[model samples]
Target: MEISDLERIARDIRRRDIQAVYEAGAGHVGGEMSVIDLLAALYFHVLRIWPDQPKHPDRDRFVLSKGHTACALYVVLAERGFIPEDEISTFLQPYSRLNGHPNCNKVPGVETNTGPLGHGLPVAVGMAKAAKLSSANYHTYVITGDGEMQEGSNWEAIMAAAQFKLDNLTLIIDHNRFQQGASLSETNDVAPFRPKLEAFGWEVTEINGNAMAEIVPALEHRGGRPHCIVAHTNKGHGISFMQDRVDWHHKVPSKEQYELALAELSEAL
Candidate 1:
């Protein structure tokens, strides 16, 4: 898809994310907004898989480590035909498969069940290792919140990915600079991610995560080592009021707020 087309899809996803969260009365709206563009670029442009054959052995894999933002992912998956688009309205309802976190077993496009921070990269590493061991010729991509980088497990996986030389693995950090409670600077301050990741022996590319032009190339870039893209993104990208506001982390918008957010997202389309 062209960058403009991907941006349009991202706007649609953002609108759906707002609607789903407003209806569900809860969701990680801020982070969801931050990562939608990246998701759109991947699902619409870079990812290699048939929605009908999600388990195709040659298919590329995507693991959303910041799974609290699953509503955004659900919108992307539905848009990509991995699941029925109407199913998105059932998000977080009773017995709904679209829970607050993604469950790979139930969701066709989801490659792993992820909600806990720091889990997706390790699983992505495993996926890459599997492909390497079996010579499957498929790539694996995983995205995590920048705040989630504080988790010890991510560092462990970082070491392992480099140690094992899994060039097929790609890690995209949604560096929106905020966690649930505080800014990343106040919480743990893991900025300057490029140097840290490069020191760990991975090639690093930093980009505006919300830009389709930047996201697609960073995802498609090939190197001799595991690749890490430090996507410097805004917490709430498209909407004016929500952008970089910490309170919107999981706050359900009021009816008026919802209307304004919807308009903002739709205008971008």
Candidate 2:
């Protein structure tokens, strides 16, 4: 897909994200909106995968570490034909497979179930190592919330990845600077991510996480060791009222708020 097409798809994804959250009455709206562009670039242009063959062994792996934003992933997966787009309406409903977080067993495109803050990186590291050990030609990518990096497990995986020199692994940190209840500074600042990853023997790239151009290149870059992309992003990226606001982290927008947000996103298309 062309960059222009990806940009339009991202806007559509943002619109879907808002609608899904509004209808479900719950979701990680802020983070979901913040990461849709990155998701679009991956699903549409970067990752090598077939929606019809979700289990293809050679397909690249992607684990959304900040899986509370599963709503956004669902929208992207739906748009990319992994699942029916209409199924999105059932999100968060009782007994619905589209729960608040993704479930790989039930969701077509999800590589693994993820919700716990620090789980995805270790799993992705293992996946990368497995590919290296087995000589499988596949890449492993994981995206984690910046706040979640405070978990010690990620650093352990970091060490193991660097030691193993898993060049096929790509870790993208959605550095939106806000967590559930407050900004990272108010909670625990994990800034200066690039230096830390580089010090751990990984090549690092920092980019405007919301820009389609920046996102695609950052995700596609490869090196001789594990790679990390520090994606600086706003909390609620597409909406005028929500950007950088901590309150939108998990709070449902009011009807008026939703209308305004939808308009702001749709206008971009």
Candidate 3:
């Protein structure tokens, strides 16, 4: 698809995510907004997925390690035709499949259930390694928040991916600066991600995560070793007032705030 179309779809996803958070009265909206562009690029432009055959054995795998932002993933999945788009309204409702986190069984496009920090990368590594063992060509991709990188498990998985030489695996870090409570620098700074990833024997690319021009090329890159994309993005990207604000990490938008955000996103379309 064209980059312009991808950008429009991303803005639409952001608008839907904002609406869901406003209606549900709870969500990690800041992270959702930050990561939606990457998700949009992946699902719409890069992933080799079958919306009608979510369990196809040879299909590429994608795992959202920073699963708190599953609302954004759900919106993208629905837009990609993996599920009914109207189901987004059931977000966070009682007995609703559209819960705060993505569930693989209940959600057609989700690969595995992920909510706990640091688990998705390990699982993705395994998935890639499994393909290698099975002599399959499917690639595996995983996205992790920079904050979540502080977890020791991710490092272990990183080391394993390199040692296994799983070139089919790709990891994208949503380097949005702020986490749930404070800036990543104020907590456990994982900045300067490129050198670290390269030192671990994986190729690394840095890009403006919210920019479609840079995002599509980076995500499409392939190399002989595991790849890492350090995607620098703002915490609340699409909405003007919320951008870079740490408090919006999981804060529910007031009615006025929601209207303003919706207007801003719609106008961008």
RMSD of each: 0.7, 0.8, 0.7
Q: Write the per-residue lDDT of candidate 1 for residues 219-268, one digit (tens) a residue.
A: 99999999999999999888899999998888889999999999887787
Model 2 clash pairs are none
TM-score (all chains, Cα) for each model: 0.99, 0.98, 0.99
Give the TM-score comparing model 3 with the true structure, all chains together.
Answer: 0.99
Taking the tens digit of each residue's C-alpha lDDT, what string does model 2 give over 98-141? Answer: 99999999999999999989999999999999999999999999
Tens digit of per-residue lDDT, candidate 3, span 1-269: 89999999999899999999999999999999999999999999999999999999989999999999999999999999999999999999999999898999899989999999999999999999999999999999999999999999999999999999999999999999999899999998978899998889999999999999999999999989999999999999989999999999999999999999999998888
How many times do residue backbones clash in model 2?
Answer: 0
Instruction: Look at candidate 1 and tell me the lDDT of residue 241.
Output: 94
Scanning candidate 3 in windows of ten residues, the lowest lDDT window is 190-199
Candidate-wise lDDT, in order: 0.93, 0.92, 0.94
**Which candidate, 1 or 3, has the higher lDDT?**
3
Candidate 3 residue spans exceeding 4 A from truth = none
Q: Count the backbone clashes (under 3 Å) in each candidate.
A: 0, 0, 0
Scored by lDDT, the top model is 3
